[model samples]
Target chain A: MRYIASAVFVIGVFVIVTAVTTQHAAKLDPYMYDYMIENFEDDTHAKNAVAAILLDYRMYDTMFEALILLTAIIGMKQFLPGAADLRARDELESVDQTEATGEQSSERPSE
Target chain B: MSGPVSDTMPTDESIVLQMVVGLLYPFMLLFGFYVILNGHYTPGGGFQGGSVLASLFVARYVVYPVDDTDTETLHSIQRVFLALIVIAPSAVLFTGVIARNPEFRSLYLTTMDVLIGVQVGFGLGVAVLRFAFFQGVGKTWHL
Candidate 1:
């Protein structure tokens, strides 16, 4: 039963991907590349056409890419065993050490 | 608490490896910066350059595993870079400044590239350092 369900799910995903790719290819205008090449400098003011495409023409994608990096770091922090706890304890130890030294210095002048 | 792991791995035995990496370090850093700064005029961009920069940490580990990095500070700064990455483009897009001044387009492209390069470099560097610490090598901080 599990094998049949897994096979059916894989086939469904493949069909969806193929249909989307074919539809996308049929709708794409070949001359769009020519247009970008001719006017990218004027439109985006980038010397490199690829830079113009990445930073100007498709900027939202780059923004979300940064977001993904941030999210990955946050998630990794949660999984690393005892790392956060150790960092917190180190900070606390520094604070307590400072306080203890301060008390010793103050008591010495009075004594 | 954990056992007293040495602050730095015993790397004094390998003088040749240390010298070689020390010689190559600055050049690799300069190349990474060049790739990022010249992204507007070249094939390389932020992601590629950032990975190059992050590789320096791995190299440092290979030579001497030292948990000298302030991951807390790096964590904060990387998030700030992400915020700038999101804000800079949206501000330009919404304020319609680029439409009024074509020159701003070049400046914006350069800024985004630098911001992204720094963000990725620091983020990946922090991840690698954290992983190293998790492996029980830090002398002071136990994990």
Candidate 2:
């Protein structure tokens, strides 16, 4: 029974993905590339069509891609212990030592 | 802290040395941003920019001794900036899912650029600090 259920779930996902891809394929216009290439000179002044496409037409995409790089850094910092905690403890120790010295100096005459 | 151990001493010369070292930080930071902003048109992009930004820490270390500059406080600031690096890209990715655009392939590039910049910067900074403070040995300091 479990095998049958698993098989059915897999099949259902496959069908959904296939349907979506087919729908997208139908909507794609091949001629749009030619149109972009023809107008590339007048608008962006970029020599490479690919550069024009990326920087001008798809600038937003480029921005988000940069964000992805940022996220990875964050993730690494979170997951890795690194030297952050060690550095913090060192500061606390120094502070504690200073306070202890101050207390001893004040009490020296009284004792 | 007593009588200035040679290791802990901030010599008079070191002060002048630190000031000179500090002068170069802004330029390094600005260059990183320049690389990031022009990445779309030029050879470098966010990854390079992030690295350039992170290099500022290294510049600081080289100019001033770690003991003189309070490494502990700097670590906290590093954590906050690193967190921003992680959260920003995730937010972008989450937007794509909410919008239900499975074919939103363009989102990948933006996220990649930002995260790479952050990773390069943070990674380089941390690596430099770790190696420097630890003296390239695997021994861990208890702080």
Candidate 3:
């Protein structure tokens, strides 16, 4: 059942993508590339248009790109077992103290 | 994304293989740096060079799993790059606008490319380290 659901979902995505990228929609920005290439050296000062667009014209995107990479790095670090040991140890210690005091384990670890 | 971490480090001792891989590692890193350095004049740029640099860490991890830096130091280095990547553009823009220096415009682009390369390289290294070593998962960030 899960596999069937996933297959249907994927098929739906493919159909949606195909419909959205039809001939007219795909050709909307056809001349934009020519314009960019023409203005590349004059406005950007760099020999490469890819570099100009990526590094200068759309620089804000580069900053966001850094943010995205940092977020992914931080996300992966958070999942590492060593990263959580300190908090887990603290929680376990609090649980042990709660048991000794005959208090409910449901209570948060204040210490 | 949090799943059971697998021990992927090789425990075997292959002297020939290790030596060959070790030799290739430095050269690959040099090539990655070259890609970054020649980004504007050539075809490569920040992401391309950044991925090249990141692949060094990935390659080292593949060869020897135990070879990784401490997370604290990695975190500090990444933070520094992150700050620079974020701040340098603003500084350049300020120079371009305030000082009205035309040269700073191109400098701004090249500068960001270099900063992005460093930030991305270490960011991936940390991510790879986290995957290779399983200390546990926490909801908060240390860096």
Which candidate tops lDDT? 1
**What is candidate 3's lDDT per residue for B20-139, written digit by digit as tens?**
778998898888888787778789977888888888876765556553357768777888988987777677664476246666666766777787787887777777667655543332
State the C-alpha lDDT per candidate.
0.81, 0.57, 0.72
In candidate 3, the residue pairs with backbone N, CA or C atoms under 3 Å apart (3 or more residues apart, or in different chains) clash, namely: A80-B136, A81-B135, A81-B136, A82-B135, A82-B136
Q: Rank by DockQ, descending?
A: 1, 3, 2
The best candidate in terms of TM-score: 1
| Candidate 3 similarity to native, TM-score | 0.71
Candidate order by lDDT, decreasing, is 1, 3, 2
DockQ of each: 0.54, 0.05, 0.46
Models ranked on TM-score:
1, 3, 2
Give lDDT tens digits, candidate 2, residues A1-111. Answer: 999999999999999999999888765686988889898645554444654565456656755554464454456546554455655766677768877777655644453
Give RMSD (Å) of candidate 1 vs. truth: 6.5
Q: What is the interface RMSD of each candidate, in Å?
A: 1.8, 7.5, 4.0
Note the clash tally of each candidate. Answer: 0, 21, 5
| DockQ score of the complex predicted as candidate 2 | 0.05
